[model samples]
Target: MTSSPLSPYLRDFERLADLETSVHSLLSSHGQEATFHHVKAVAQKAAELAERFSGNVEEVSAAAWLHDISAIIPNRERIAVAQGLRLEVLPEEADFPMIIHQKLSAALAEEAFGVTSQAVLSAISCHTTLKANASKSDHIVFVADKIAWDQAGTPPYLPDLLVALEASIEAASLVYLDYLWEMRARLKVLHPWAKAAREALRADVSKLQTDKSLRF
Candidate 1:
C-alpha cells in the first residue's frame, strides 16, 4: 500500500486491521514471539486507555502495535540502521542502542506499513521514552506499554499507576516517569527526552492538583 496519513474512520479501521496482521507476521517470522504478545497486550491496554482518557483509539492502537516492530533488527545494528534511515541518533541511543528501537519502529511503520500519520508516528517514536509535551495518544501508548510491560512478572508499579490513570493520562505518565526518575542511577543512560517528559508531567500533574483544590 502507498504511504498515506490516516483516512476516515471506516478506511482507518480496515487499514489498522491490516497493519495489526502484518505486524504479527513480521514479529513471528523474526522470532519475536514474546514481543508480539507484549505488543498485543499493549494494544489492549491502549484501547482501554483511549476510552478512559478520550484519546484517538485508532491512532493509539496503531502505535501500540508498531511500537516495537523494529526489534527484528539486532540491538548491535540499531544505531547503524537508524543512521541509515536518517533518524536522529541521540547520544544516549548510541551508548545503548536498544533504546533506539522506538525510532526504528516508527520508521518501519511508515516505510513498510504506510503509517504516515504524525500522531501515530510520534507516539510510536516515543513510546519507550516519552518526550516533553506528549500528545494524548503519546501519553496513552507510553502508559499502556508500561502497564503491559514485557518483563516476566506483573509490573510492581501497576497498582499506583492505575490509580493515577483514573485521574488523567498525565497523572499516570507522571507515576511511571517518577519511578524511572527514582531509579535513574541504575539506568544505562537517562535519555534527555525522558527527563524533559518527567519535568513536563510534574508541571501537568501539579496543575491538575491545583485545579482540583480550587474546585473544592
Candidate 2:
C-alpha cells in the first residue's frame, strides 16, 4: 500500500497542532478553559508577530501552546508538587507558589510529549516571568501571553504596547514592563525577574537612543 508522505514543514506543523489539541482536551477536563484560550491566543499572536521579526513561528507557536500546561496543577498545591520534584523555589514563589507553573510546564512538556527542541523548551520555560537572558522566542511568547489575553474587554496596556511594537519588539517589551511596574509592581509585588528585565530593557533602549543621538 502506498501512503502519502508529509513534508517536513507539514509534519512539524501537525506535530505542534496535535500537541495543542491534547493540551486543550486536558485543560477542558480540568475546567481550565480560560487557560486554554489564553495559550491558544498566545500561539496565534506569536505566529503573527514572528512574521514582522523573522522569528521561528513554528517554535513559538508550539511553545505557546504548551507554555501554560501546568495550569492543570491546582493553585494551592503547586509548591508541594514542585517540592516533590525537588525543584528550587525563589522566596516569592515559596510564598505564592502558583508562579511555579513555568518550570512545571517545561518539565511536563518534555516528560509527557518527548518535546526535545531546546528553543521550544526555553520559550516555554520563560514565557511566564521572562528571565533576563531570555531568547527572542521567549520574548515573543511572553509578550503574546499578555497581549492576547483570554477574558473579555481590551487590556489597557495593549494600546501603548502596540505603539511601542510599531517601533520594535524591544520597545514594546519596555512598554510592557513599564506598565507592569506602574500597575502591580509599584504598588509592590514585582517579580525579581521582571525587575531585572526592566533594568536590562531600559539599558538597551538608552543605548539605542544614544546611538540615534550620535547619528543626528
Candidate 3:
C-alpha cells in the first residue's frame, strides 16, 4: 500500500514524542512525575516561544519533548555511562546530570532515532544550559525553558522576564547568565560548560559596558 508522505520534521516529532512518553513513563515508575511534568512543561513553553521568534516549529517542539530523556536514567548511571563513552562531560554536569539531561537526550535522539541534524541536536543539547556558540534555536529553547508558564512560586512581576527577553539579545543573554550564576550558587557547585557559558556572557556584558562608555 502506498503511504502518505510525511515531512521529515513531522516524522521526527512523532518519533520524539513517543520516545518522550516512554521516558516519562519510566520516570513515573520511579515516582518522579513532578520532574517529568516540569521538564515537559518547559519543553512546551520553549516551543511556543520558538514559534513566536520565527523558529522551526516542528524542530523546537520535538526538541522540547526529547530534551530530558536522560532523566529516565539515574544520575550516577549517566555519569558512569558518559565517562565510559568518553563524552567529555563537565564535572558539574556529571555531578548533576538531572539538571542537564538534555545532553544525553541529544545523544539518544541522534544515535537511537537517527536525528542527525546538528541544529535540532544542538537545540536539544543546550535547552537547559546555554553554550558559547549557541544557535538561534538554542537560544529559543533556552529562553523557553527559563520562562515556562508552569513555573510555580515565581515572583509577581515575572512577566518582566519576557519583556526583558524581547528587548534585545544582549539583555536576554544577561538574564540567562544571571540564572546560571544563581543556580550554580544555590547548588554550591560548578561545571566547566556552565563556567564557559558564564564567561561568554561576562564578555558580552563587558562589551556592552565598553560601548556605553564610548558613547558617553
Q: Which stretches of candidate 3 lie over 4 Å from their true place?
A: 1-32, 149-152, 155-160, 182-185, 205-216
lDDT of 2 by residue, 107-157 (tens): 767765678999999888777677776678888888888798766899888
Backbone atom clashes (below 3 Å) for every candidate: 0, 0, 0
Taken over the whole model, the C-alpha lDDT of each candidate is 0.85, 0.78, 0.65
Q: Tell me each candidate's RMSD, in Å, in order.
A: 5.8, 7.7, 7.1
Per-residue lDDT of model 3, residues 61-123, tens digit only: 767666666655566577666665456677667566765566777776665467777888988
The weakest ten consecutive residues by lDDT in model 3 span: 2-11
Residue 157 of model 2, lDDT score: 88
TM per candidate comes to: 0.88, 0.86, 0.72
36-102 per-residue lDDT for model 1 (tens digits): 9999999999999999878899999989999998877888777877787677898999999989889
Task: Count residue pairs with overlapping backbones in model 3.
Answer: 0
